[model samples]
Target: MTDRPDPFAAPFGSLFGDSMTQAELVDGTYSYSGSAQPMENFSLHPATHVLHYGSACFEGLKAHRQSNGTLALFRLDDHVERMRQSIGLLRMPVPDAALIRSLIIDAVEANADFTPDPPGSLYVRPTFIGTAPNIGAAAVPSDMGLLYVICSPVGDYFAGGIRPLTIYVETKVPRTTPQFGMVKSGANYVMALGPTLDAKRDHGADQVLFATADDITETGASNFFLIDDDRIITRQLDESFLHGVTRDSVITIAGDLGYSVEERPLSPSELADWAETGEVFLSGTAAVVAPVGTVIVEDSARTVRDGEPGPNTLRVRDALTTLLTGDADDPHGWRTTVSG
Candidate 1:
């Protein structure tokens, strides 16, 4: 067999693994029976419901290869549960929670040899979409649906190592609708793409801090957090943004390290006040815990504490990494070992 190209060196989504797991829904029931076939183009009709009505959702999580040569998925159950919730909200027929988890684990194990070590991981993407070609009226629930999980070995998101990022605090444009914000649906991210692109172009920012009319929501794809000398504060969970699994992991780890944790509504005006005395960071699956060095509010800017990755941010990130790699005791039982 020919050697597979290094997915880590390829651009995002361009290089997929050799195989994938697929399932289909027909007449309101799911039938899963497929192997990891070669990655290739998908066949879909021109008027597919997903193309016209945007009936699709997806989840992102990683599988880490531990130092002991064993692979474990971080918060796999949480991700499966969130995907189920998204399917329900989107009115798409999907498999049970157990089936979804099995699909994800099986796909990861099938591509075990591609799971990179340490800072690199096998990124798993599970997507669901309506395939029926009736675009005139999509109010009727889709009779057909497709579910699949694709794996890719991804390197560090920032090639230059961990550094503070500059973010634009946007108040006028909302990230997404309040009802759909919590769901891991494609439409949610689609809504923020335009504004985020504008922020990057006009303000030279890395991400957009989407805020509600009165409260701050989240960045483009990650949740936001503030780290002070003794406390960690973030926006309380509501219908305005995604409740990230990584965010929960960070909060739990921080609390264990003797830092006070508070979840409340954060406003744009409070950025200067918080920056005066604390450090800020973004938390998510891809980012883990990315420090925020600067926050640009309209034309004015405020530098985070010391304008660098705060000691507390680094501490929490290290703690989480240790737990994920099996160096530290996983008190939360978040990791699931995948059989090769």
Candidate 2:
């Protein structure tokens, strides 16, 4: 057996598997080996288009070690499709969904030994970058690109595991340009980085909720939600932020749990009022379903519903957890089983 570190001791996404799968696009065609290879650094020209002009994107999803001792990937198809959309937006020739799907499965199967027990799983990252080494093509998208899938052994996204998160609400600064909100590119993330770091330094907060002039879209990394006894509310899907796969899962799960689901534009003022009676949380592949215990707005820290993880939050998190672990019936057919 390959020796592995305790996932709980490693920072999320910090420890990667030993092997990876890759492909390269040349003149609108992609060439990929049918299997995973040893993970190694790429020798890139300093003038690589992705290094300067920034044509790159990535997707994060996971493969869980199921209760039946089999490995199953959570929402694999959805993630694969979304990754295609991201590369398409970058103006690169997107690979067929089936191709990306095969790369992901192949990478995971090669490193199946790294998958950890429940609460810890193999974090799969499928990435794309424009490789045409031409910094002069700043305004023009690169035609040649590279795509690869890598795996990491990860634990909790937030420290303290399933505990609540404290968010700093920024009503002024937007996370990214409206046109690029739906893209999972490194540029989009770097645009949000300064604000996130500012929030952390200034407020000692775990994350920043980008309200953008009272318009609540999403946080830097995950989708936000407001949950009470009877209703589940979130920002409506638009081009303003990522339409998260995990967010859709929670909404579906919420509907099955019989909660009234509301998808509309939300504002910071409204979030504050909602927090008075309900619970708040962020959802994503990395975050899963993390509760919000506190939200800082206008420099005032407000505890969310007695400043603890609420019952409704736990209920939703548990529901999603069981489904991922194969302990509950997968009514949605979301789990894709992978052969060892």
Candidate 3:
């Protein structure tokens, strides 16, 4: 542990744990070792299905080293269910929920020595890829696949800790295909790369908010939100974007704090109007709750209410943090403790 680089100082997701768990699917059946194994590179054929056909997806969640000297996985079951949904959508045979849960637990517990302190956590990545070695089967789902869970000791997804972000509104380019938007696939991420890089180079933005003809969807990697003194508003769930776990947690905690949660269609005009008074933020597994201070719509850049982290935003953030670190009671049963 002393020889490893500090996760806080290093780039996020660069420092990995020593152990991992994996399973293989062949001929419509799955096989796992029922234990953790040493982390290593995988050998794949040049014509692997995922390489040419894009038959891959993944889920991101965290295992926090709690205030009480224990480690717990946040929203573990929900992530498992979402990963299964993603696999099913990829036209592959989905692994049972129990198998996925056990794999995560085994991987986390095996790497418990690598767990960092609060404000830093063990970022767990459960990935699935097709390995059928068939470049000709673009329309056919792979009969062979690999499912694995690995851990990375991470600090912050965005650098400089938690601060307000600058978002660029993209009204012309859609993030991904509408029907497949809900899947957590790398293809969806690659679709946003061109616009995101352009925004960074031209507008100096932190992330690109895809509106696609004034219909607000989400940022590249997180869910969007509009927060104020009384209510919280966001785009209702459909097939247009990823439904975030932290987004759900925020809505639940905000409701517990008496803020009205409204899930509906949000437009760029409505966002510009809300930025005049209300607060805005992004939520995700990697980014717990990120405050937005500025938004660039076309040629105009609008600041969100003095361009600082608002009180309500901080309040919700604090509550979620407390619950995550085990300082508060688990009323919703969101945390699952893993054995050290």
Candidate 4:
């Protein structure tokens, strides 16, 4: 039997699996060296471009251990494509998609025994950082880059499991730039951290709903969705928030379940008005589908359906969980089984 780390005792983002995949971008070419020995620290100069200018991009996805004892990756190809797009948008050298995919599969397979069962997954983080050391200047198209994939066995992201989360809506601060919002880069989250922390500290909220100039964008790390009795409404995908893969999956599954999914601009006023009748939730790879109990907007806290996880939210989450674990027929073909 393979020795696995005690996930329950491991600190967040600290305990990684036995090995990781490393690749280097040199002279505009990517050289993948397959899986490598686990290293706790990275060697980079003090003037690394990523440290100063934030030329970094990343992708987050999971490999789940199904009931049938098979390990499957949730939408691996889509994540790879998204990572490629993020690199392109950041003007960083892009890694080969096929190579990256292979690296991910290999890393997961290498650490397959470490993946926890249901309610836990192998959290895969594929990161690209600009390694060029030039403090006075920004990397001109990011000449040097490092691409590495790390896996961690994580349980539920939310401490209380699938309970409804309280979110605070920020009408002043924007989540990210219009053009770069869709990209998975560290800068975007950094921009949102202050507001989120304030929300948690001041309002006792779980997350922040980042509204750009009064227009609702997204929650801190996930896409926001509102479910009415008849239809589902979410903010339209633009340049400000991430196009979450889990959001896409939820929308598709909701559509298949006969719910009309509407993508449009959602204002804070509209959200306040809609909160009376609609159910709100945040969707992401980490949180999956986390229902919103209340949204603290400014001084007033608006409750969504008595501040509880609504029936619709629970139903969708159940459906998604079933689909993800291979209990349901996967029509979208998102699952990729991994071999140990």
The most accurate candidate by lDDT is 3
TM-score, cand. 4 vs. native: 0.95
The local lDDT score (0 to 100) that residue 324 gets in candidate 1 is: 80
Model 3, residue pairs in steric clash: none
**TM-scores of all predicted structures:** 0.96, 0.99, 0.99, 0.95
Q: What tens digits encode model 3's per-residue C-alpha lDDT throughout 1-340?
A: 7998999999999999999999999998889999999999999999999999999999999999899899999999999999999999998998999999999999999999898898999999999999998889999999899999999999999999988999999999999999889999999999999999999999989999999978998999999999999999988989779989998999999999999999998988888989999999999988899999998987589999999999888999999999999999999999999987
What's the distance in Å from true for residue 185, model 3? 0.2
Global lDDT for candidate 4?
Answer: 0.85
> Which parts of model 4 have CA positions greater than 4 angstroms off?
1-5, 8-12
Q: Write down the worst ten-residue block by lDDT for model 4.
A: 1-10
Runs of candidate 2 exceeding 4 Å displacement: none
What lDDT tens digits, residue by residue, belong to model 1 across residues 118-204? 787888999999888888756876778988899888766654558899999988889898898888988888899999999889988
Deviation of model 4 at 100, angstroms: 1.5
lDDT of 4 at 109: 85
Residues 1-340 of candidate 4: C-alpha lDDT, one tens digit per residue:
1466666556545567878887888898988876655645787899898989899899999998887889999999999999999999998766778988987898888877778777788899988998888887663755788888889888788876888788888888787777888889898888888888888899998898888678888887898998976789888887667889999999999999999999988888888887898899999999999999888776699998788899999899999998878888889999999896
Question: Using alpha carbons, what is the TM-score of model 1?
Answer: 0.96
Tens digits of per-residue lDDT for model 2, 1-340: 3466788898898998899999989999999979899999999989999999889999999999999999999999999999999999998898999999999999999999899898899999999999988979999989788899999999998978888788999988899999999999999899999999999999989999998878999999999999999999999999879999999999999999999999999988888787788999999999999999999988998889898899998999999999999999999999999976
